[model samples]
Target: MKLVVRRSVCFQGHQIPDQEAACQQSYGPDLEYRDLMRVTAIVICAALAGCQAVPGEGPLASAINEDAGRSPAEIGRVNAAVFDIVDVDNHTARLVSDYVSTALKRRFGIGGGPGRAVIGIGDQLKVTIFEAGADGLFSTNDSKQATIDVVVQPDGTAAIPYVGTVRFAGRTLEQARQEILASLKSKAVEPDVIIGMGDTPSRSVTVAGAVNRSAQIPLNLSGEQITDVIAKAGGPTSQPYESYVTLVRGKKTGTALLKSIVENPSENIYVQPGDQIFVTRDPRTFTLLGAVKSNSRIEFGANDLNLLEAVALGRGGNDETVNAKGYFLFRYEDPEVVLGLLGQRRFDELARKGMQPDKDGRYPIVYRFDMSHADSLLVGQTFPVKSRDVIYASRHPAVDLTKFLRVIGAPVGIAVQGAAISNNLSD
Candidate 1:
């Protein structure tokens, strides 16, 4: 009472070899192919059930599952509160006109150099007195030359031979010479004085950090600038494009890109006495992740970098896997900017929850760009990329589907092949 049966199974369009053909030819009526068909159906059903058990668990699925509880409308509501959806054109113009233009107008005033250099405390002076007589009070024998080295004291005066103390601090070289001549006039007949600077410790700017040489450059009557100080310090250790200069004058401080300081005259402000200039290799960088060609930190070579340029640097979004509509930039934006984007009511709500802006008055922001349209290419050209930004391009639905199919198809194909081989071996 032996029964014969035939079964056909396919996994992802790959047909399983016919086990019944060999079984029927070798075992005749003794072999029951119905059992083999039953086993094949059970294995495939188990595989499909396993896949169905974890539906929507592909790469992109899992990646987006974190926010799956929220619907699209709800997600839009949440994003509207914390995110800014701007077209490329509007953001591009806003960045250039608002951020860059404003920064260029901020220039520190530098004093014009007077005819005579002013004297200050801690300055070393070389005084030479010339007498009209053969042997004056400052002269010995027939020599009229009397050279004296005196450092300007804290009291702003310098000691002179028989001339008492002369106040030289805050006085120009010509003014100090006149004061010295007036003092020596009573003691000697027609005494002429020449005062020269031996050391100029007070009139210098300190340059430090990321330079070939850290030094204190003297500020002369020519009026040195920020660039001049950096040059005197042997320039920056890093590339100018990849470096920044910080100028600290007294209590006030300002920072600009080294390349900008070199190219833009306004950013190359005058370097004053006691000003500290630090050249640092702290280039503005953004982190690229997800479906980008390269997922790493990308440094900006210049002062301005738009979204298109940033994406190009990351090798453009992965064409095969990226979701064109889901490109995002994560950043902390100024509260005022966020207010302008999200409106005052939503901002106030977030503020009430103790989500205060940072020291820079900026709140957490996420910027989404839809690259699905051709016009978005123009928008990406003008949208600026700020420092510490995170750029991400989500995966496409097809990529997730392909991944899901692979997960299920592999085991089913293996089971079909194994069942066919076992049936052949048994026969």
Candidate 2:
């Protein structure tokens, strides 16, 4: 089939002047410069306006799968809900990272550090009685002192000779010793008493789960930290980042990453007797999605991962399509933590807008960090990436326009060229 190319295209029912003086003969060659400019502007504006309506190339599969990939048992983890997006900066990054509601030192400390060791049930105690002179009731002339074994019963009371049964479960060794000496003075010659620790089986920290050897490490007067107890149990069975140390003391339970305890000395808190130390393996990971080179779950190493390093682990965003400014990380943030990032003013604004944390005391939030800026790049290098966080790199807006232009640009260019040639011929 023969193809025909129309040199003179229709524009709002107007005829173009051909080389044979087509427009000059019919509608007169005066198309008016102002009218011409109006038409030109409309054409240019129409092309520019189409940029907004242009769509991206394709919806690629995410590095992190959604509900479709989750097992029925675990599918609840991919619940989709409306969330807030906050802009991240150096101040926000630092505060949100370091913020912890109950730090080890704050929760377990007494008098700026772990308090003096107190006698507890299963703590073995021995009392030594010293007489001023010769034997009275028990001490002979040959030996002026006598040692007696003391046992703390499950009822929180210890049975001792002369003293009978006294509450000693929570008392210090010195206090118990003083009580014994006072009780003995009434029955014997001027007496003094000293208390010393013996085999203490129940006065120990229980170290269980993901360790080389699960055991109950005995606590001494010197005291032992969580790390010390874990080390004694043959250390964690996993990497520091992958290991979790949970301390259950009575009704309170505190958990910290093994990596954090190693890096921050303050987090390596002292373990009290009867404290349950559970060394569990919980791998720290982040989901890399959107325009990244490799969209997959990335596991943390021995150290905490910075934003830049996390991105690097995903091979950063796809070079051509990634919008550097659209880099975002999704995480469930605490309310107080939101305050740190938003500041009082912005936080109040959100509160006024009826924004609140969920039942879990966490705000479903995403932090946007514009890597397009040199300063943000620097900040991202040091900004910490939390475990289970979701990182997304959006496609640039210009990418859509580029694709749209590639398909329609040639026709627009040809039309403009033909119009110019017709105008020159009319002149």
Strongest candidate by TM-score: 2
Counting clashing residue pairs in each candidate, in order, gives 1, 1
Candidate 2 per-residue C-alpha lDDT over 242-287 given as tens digits, one digit per residue, 9 for 90 to 100: 8888888899777777887888777877777778989889889999
What global local distance difference test value does model 1 have? Answer: 0.67
**TM-score of each model, paired residue for residue:** 0.63, 0.71
- In model 1, the runs with Cα more than 4 Å from the true position are 1-83, 101-117, 130-146, 248-254, 301-304, 333-365, 395-427
Model 1's C-alpha root-mean-square deviation from the true structure amounts to: 12.2
Evaluated at residue 213, the lDDT of candidate 2 is 96
lDDT of each: 0.67, 0.68
- Model 2: ten consecutive residues of lowest lDDT: 60-69
lDDT of 1 by residue, 114-165 (tens): 2345788898989999988876888766688788998999999988979888
